[model samples]
Target: MSGQRRTATRSEHALEDLDGAALSYAARFAEQSEGRRRDHLRDELVQLALPFAGRLARRYRGRGEPLEDLEQVARLGLVKAVDRYDPERGSFTAYAAVTITGEIKRHFRDRTWGVHVPRRLQDLTIEVSQATAVLTSELSRSPTVAELAARLETSEEDILAALESAAGYTPASLNGPVGDDGPAELGDMFGALDADLESVDDRLTVSGLLYRLPARERRILAMRFYGNYTQSDIAAEFGISQMHVSRLLSRTLTWLRQAMLTDTPPRWESTGAPPEPPDAVTVSVDRADGRVQVGIRGELDRSAAERVRCALVDVVCAAGTDEVLVDLDGVGFIDAAGIAALLASHEAARRAAVRLRIADPQPYVRRSLIVAGLAPLFT
Candidate 1:
């Protein structure tokens, strides 16, 4: 044992001597003029100090960084020390050791964290880690938050925050396996698909389209879908037949489906037309000088809206017609369904590059259009 101690002492002395010689050489190299000779001497100095830098880098091993990368950082620091060293200020050996160690530490602090943490918290994390290790060894167990805070001379909140920040240093990969035996990933545990989320878009779309329907039809839809009422129940509440309720529901649903699928919503048709015959609405078309005049005569209610819209669309689609005038003077009354049909025909005319204008509308029909916000389009 005595012989081994002596041998170790000799090895230490030999290293000390080598370090002294290298420092002396570095000082000489710094004094040389900037030329090939100086460059050669600088290279020699770097080669001589490489082993010392490697030793400093080895002190940081098993710290998540690769040994080769740490050594590279240390060697870079050594080169900087050699270039910036002023021999008169201090000893090169001590200065180079500090510079290299600091470079290695900075590499870990700046680059190794998976998430950005404040500098203060990062330092606190290190101090807390060292304190926990020491306390665990002394007490033979993990230290509590209060114990850690006391040892670090900080509040328990700060200690807890530091503990949380430490996790940012090396976060687990989301793609990593959950366990040794499990095939699932860490991300798989986060959440599953929400069945209702798939219908969220449909719900939003239908909510907007529902207002376009007549109030009775809208009520019927709400009663059936939202209130979960049977057709017979809705029929009894509305004082209508079950067949009428079913027809209204079917028509409302079909219009909503078409509205959701298309940029232009289809015109609405009412199921409760008061036994009025189809001849109640009449349409006449006359063309002259590249213009077509369409005359509509009737109440222009839901029962007549679809017929008037179809006739106007046919007139607009006809070739060689640049302008269409819809005469609603003979119409005595109009409703939401009638307004929707006119708007639909206007949209069709606009797409077909034909100019369509409303020539005349009765006072009631004009007021209805104004209330529906369609008067501007007609004007």
Candidate 2:
């Protein structure tokens, strides 16, 4: 369920075909009872399912795990599914999917942790998860730090620190891929070695996506990453708060992720004559820490607003990114179209059940957001 944000609604789309075919083969093998026949069937099923395993492994690429490792974990899950699969229970595709997906998630919870952590931390996590879920069910919507504090009847400062620390302790963000093609699939997380795209070319693709950012973000990203400066150092260079720099770094990372890993696909529908999610705008990406921050700074005149709105919608709507920050800090002015774009982004974030934070509001940005009654939503 980590990657799967949207639940299966229409069964019409059907489970994967190869999985079904594999199940059919297994059934035929069972009928034959010949040793050779069963061996051939099992081998054939493995071959058929190899692609799905790769796809699943791709889903976990940037979550701080190696592709080879994730593939093995997913393969184990697939193999287990093959062993336990009962055609009577459900479609082989769906059943096997559950196993592989679970294995992928378990890897995040168990092995994905790169550093050793205290068992007490795991205990605390379990406690927090249960408490948060119960409180959320009662209160409606994800509980804020303050609301959770009240529920725990503890101090707000403690709650805030706990949340931050909770975030820091994870090996990889467990919320799933930053991008989603459909149902939090593997395609969203990993940039592919296409039929072409030699290894070096992939690096260029990522760099190309980075070039699309506004000059400030691009510079900040380069200095922070290449120069290896802390956000505080970057803040000093730019005369802004470390927090602001941190937020910008996050937004820039998401933009790059959208561009590199996810290829900035056309998730949003343009309202008018605006261009699609070209390299210039609407980069779809998954981040290293698993959270993504995006800044949409271009002029959202009426003609371009609709398309940009759709792109924002895609981010908010997708069951992708555990947390999303959409910064309006760079906008010099705001208009009705711009206001609409922000609202659309906010709604999509909520729908996806992600923590959406909007930071560093310019005067016009604040005014536009307030007029649209989005202050509570963003603040």
**Per-candidate TM vs. native?**
0.53, 0.32
Q: How would you encode candidate 1's per-residue C-alpha lDDT over 1-379 as one tens digit per residue?
A: 9999998787566557655766677667768887898888778778777878899999999989999999999999999988887667777889899999999999999999999999899999999999999999999999999999999899999999999999999999999998799699998989888999999999877765665565578788889988999999999999989998887888778888889999866666664464233238788888778778888876676777888888888888883677888888866656688888899998999999988888678655787778877676574
Among these predictions, the greatest lDDT belongs to: 1
lDDT of each: 0.82, 0.68
Tell me which residue pairs clash in candidate 1.
none
Cα error, residue 230 of model 1, in Å, equals: 18
- Those runs of model 2 whose alpha carbons end farther than 4 Å from true positions after fitting are 1-16, 34-36, 115-146, 150-379
lDDT of 2 by residue, 1-379 (tens): 7335343422222234665676687679779876887878777787778777778789779867788989999999988988787777878878778899999887776764555545545445555667899987987888887777777777777666555546655545445664655457444565765765466777756654543445577689889879999888899999999998887777666656665667333232222354333223333434447767667654454656787778767766663667777766655445688677777777777767877777777655676678888787564
Over 4 Å off in model 1, which ranges?
1-14, 18-23, 134-158, 178-191, 194-197, 214-379
lDDT of 1 at 234: 97
Assess the local accuracy of residue 38 in candidate 2 as a C-alpha lDDT between 0 and 100. Answer: 81
Candidate 1: C-alpha lDDT: 0.82
